[model samples]
Target: MALDPTDVGKIAELARLEISEPELTSYVHSLTQILDLVGQMNAVDTAGISPMAHPSDSPLRLRQDIVTEQDRRQSFQEIAPATESGLYLVPKVIE
Candidate 1:
């Protein structure tokens, strides 16, 4: 899949991009190389390969889930303008 200037121009137009003439040539070369790499990769056989969640097989280490901070909800609510049932009240702006 080789990308020419015409194809690059159409791609740029479809993407709403304003590419200059010199930039269009550069894009054509770069995009053509990328497509060629993809074509090469697609030519390989991977029939027996299974999908993996990760590249490595090691299990991830996790930290213990516990409370590390003291409760300050009551102190914060005392300083607020309005709070009811442990919730801060705000003025309604929409009908």
Candidate 2:
């Protein structure tokens, strides 16, 4: 997965980026190294290993789900220019 200048140029073009010649060379080198590292990682075997949600084994501490703010939907919608069936309506700009 060694990225060449042409590959970097195509990528930059696709991403709508205007990169200089020096920057293009730097990006090619950096991207090639990243791809090589990914390739090396993919080469390792993890046959029986289970996927982990987090790297650590400790459970995450979470706060209780509670509503702190009062509902102001009705008040907001009352000031809107258009609303219908509890939903804010907007002008149709598309056909």
TM-score of 2: 0.45
lDDT of 2 by residue, 5-34 (tens): 999999999999999999988999999999
lDDT by residue (tens digit), candidate 1, 1-95:
99889999899999999999999889999999999888887777978988688989679988889888899999989999999999989998789
TM-score of each: 0.45, 0.45
Please give the clash total of every predicted structure, in order. Answer: 0, 0
Q: After best superposition, candidate 1 residue 33: deviation in angstroms?
A: 0.6
Q: lDDT for model 1, please.
A: 0.90
Report each candidate's C-alpha RMSD, comma-separated, in the order given: 10.4, 7.9
